[model samples]
Target: MRLALAALLLIPLPALAGDPLTAAEFEAYAQGKTLTYAMGGQVFGTEQYLPNRRVRWAFTQDVCKEGWWYEEAGLICFAYDGENDPQCWKFWQDGARLKAQFEGDPEGTELTEVEQTTKPLSCPGPDVGV
Candidate 1:
């Protein structure tokens, strides 16, 4: 019985995943915005913002920026300047805050007071039953 209960708890719950965004809406939200990221007080600028609704973030390079991104399977995936060679980082957004964990990094940081040219974007739909 205990094993059965453990198995039940491990079942996939798709609805607990994030909300879906439309392509048009994503473009609008990300077009002029900026994503300021920091790791242990070391700051980096993800200065370009071009977005797709189904995807989370897009764009790249220190120059002309080229990448495609999305949040699925509990991971944030970004494919930049190439195919079959995507980079993924894990993340969670709550209310006005965002947190992410980079690969090989033991700690994650919450992005605070994140300013966008427009209002901040929250995760899609209602809260998951976390």
Candidate 2:
């Protein structure tokens, strides 16, 4: 069945899905949208992407950290206020959905976009009281 094996191999598999989105694609899709991210089916965080690559993120809380994203070496990286380290991630788009994989660590976190809306992310802003 050498011919059968060859035929099977020649049969084109369906177009491979889950091709990662390019930097421009990611920015266009994320901008002006508030996306809620989940991991292991539990809500992990939410981010509101604004104009000029700015963002605000909250981890299931009212407080938000101001940040911005930049495309670096085919990955999206974020820098937040008071956080010296920049977190990088790879993003993929499956149809209308977005997926994020943290960089550097082999077992780095994976976040799925569970919900999205045009609503701006709620933020208490900087602490006004001591």
Candidate 3:
């Protein structure tokens, strides 16, 4: 019984109708918005989506990174300017909210969109002492 239960829990969840959102669909939904993502019930970070798939991501630490996304093999992958490695994620639209699964994570990290707004993301300029 324990084995069966564990297996059921391990099964991957289908993101609405057992299909991930296509590139056009994802773009239409995400563009022109800043989305707050939560992991483990805590706000992990926020991302502001701009036109032409441009994105600015900031962690709770307040460090922002500029990047852009493209669809590859049905997964959306982001490549930041300073980061050499590309981060890929699978997105799902759950009703009015959205959910994302980080690719290559064995533990399955699911980030849920908790809040969204058209307001711009606050990114501070370089440090300059007054």
Candidate 4:
């Protein structure tokens, strides 16, 4: 009986109309897109959605980092550390706007897609010098 239950649990679930997007789906949706969003007034973090819309690299405030983002069940997750106890952020997009509920906060901020570049662009213009 235990084995049967386990088998049942392992069954692949279908993607619902409003269900969370899978990593593969997420990638397809976000890959090859450059998005600009504000984090403070200066605006930081230019995200490049790779083949999976995964955060290939994020640069902001003198920091350059890479990480992965995916959806499970019905929640979207962002992991910055890429290891144990990594900082996680959850959000959802409904075609028009994205609603993000951070891990520690009970509520999230809503953001609209202002602009998306066709490809990943370099941070800190050539004159600024990395």
Could you say which candidate leads in TM-score? 3
**What TM-score would each prediction reach against the true structure?**
0.46, 0.81, 0.83, 0.53
Of candidate 4, the 10-residue stretch with the lowest lDDT total is 121-130
Q: How many residue pairs clash in each candidate?
A: 2, 0, 0, 3
* Model 2 lowest lDDT segment of ten: 121-130
Off by over 4 Å in 3: 1-18, 127-130
**Candidate 4, residues 1-130: lDDT per residue as tens digits?**
9999999999999644334455555556567787765543445456666554346445555443556676655455666554454444444455654323455555544333455778665645444322
Name the runs in model 2 displaced over 4 angstroms. Answer: 1-16, 125-130
Off by over 4 Å in 4: 1-25, 39-44, 52-54, 57-59, 81-84, 87-90, 94-99, 124-130
Across 7-30, the per-residue lDDT of candidate 3 in tens digits comes to: 999999856542688899899999
Score candidate 1 by lDDT. 0.46
What is the lDDT for 60 in model 4?
53
* TM-score of candidate 4 against the unseen true structure: 0.53
Better of 1 and 3 by TM-score: 3
Q: Sorted by lDDT, highest first, which candidate order results? A: 3, 2, 4, 1
Question: What lDDT score is found at residue 113 in candidate 1?
Answer: 21
Model 3, residue 37: what's the lDDT?
Answer: 99
Between the candidate structures 1 and 3, which one is better when assessed by lDDT?
3
Clashing pairs in 2: none
How many Å off is the CA of 123 in candidate 1? 27
- Per-residue lDDT of 27-99 in model 1, one digit per residue for the tens? 4545656565554565543434543522233222232335566655555556665466665555544454444
